[model samples]
Target: MIKENPLVVSVGECGLDYNRNFSTKKQQRYAFREQVKLACELQMPLFLHEREAHKDLLEILDDVTAENLTLPPIVVHCFTGTEEEALTYISRGYFIGFTGTICKRDRGAHLRDLLPKIPLERIMIETDAPFMNFKKGRKSSEPIDVVDVARKIGQVLAIPFEEVAGTTFKTTSSFFRLD
Candidate 1:
């Protein structure tokens, strides 16, 4: 199906969701593994979605890595993990995507502070459309809403909003090797 869709740049938007565990662990595992393999076989980058299943997710990656699977680069989209988790993935050369949800007053604010600690080159911005709405009083999000993410990240890093947008845009384009 992806081969038939030239516009699809990713093989995933897939991973475990332990937060809700909407699917059984075994089921999530199966889907996650299949998607990982598909991403590798297709030579397409993965848009990874991980929730409270970090341990399981990392374990799967380790297994795949041990098998010498040539997986394309991955981005942990709409990341809401701890700084330690973020650093762990960063150390392994995965890009971290931030969303407008990071602008919230609670944990999101902590991630905001953590952002400046991350190398600018290792970052990307996403909206995770139809979810993670951060606009004041808004209840949903859209891809175009990623601009808010860019702006918030700019505030966190003390950089101009356009600079953040341009830099992250370049970083994402380069990471995916997109034109």
Candidate 2:
């Protein structure tokens, strides 16, 4: 499917989900590995989703990197980890993608506070469509809602929203090598 869709820049939106454990840990691991392999094979960037399975996720990343699988660029989308974890991934040269969920309370706000600390060059914005709704009085998320994420990032960095949008878009395009 991806090979046929030249416009598709990412092979993922995939990873372990131990938070809800919607699937068994073993199953999640299998799925995550499969996607990683797919991304490597296709030479397409990855949009990873990790939740409460950072240990397993990091282990897999370490193993894969050790194997020299020729990993495509990777972005840990909707990052929800501590600053240390964020730094660990950044150190590996992976980009971080923020979502509108970062505007929410508690940990989300913590992410907001941490945003400015992340180099803009290493950050991207996403809406994780059909989820993480952040619109005023809206109940669901859409790709267009990425604008809100950019806005929030702008507020955190004290920059114009347009600058945030433009910079993130450019960063995402370059990371994915999008045409």
Model 1: runs farther than 4 Å from truth? Answer: none
* Native-to-model Cα distance after best TM-score fit, residue 94 in candidate 1, in Å: 0.2
Q: How close is candidate 2 to the true structure, as a TM-score?
A: 0.90
Residue 105, model 1, lDDT: 86
Candidate 2 worst ten-residue window by lDDT? 101-110
lDDT of 2 by residue, 86-139 (tens): 888888888998888887776487798777778998998888878887777988
User: Over the stretch 1-118, how does candidate 1's per-residue lDDT look in tens digits?
Assistant: 7766868878778999989989999999988988898888788998898998888998988877778888789999889988888988898889999987787888597798778778
- Candidate 1 collision pairs: none
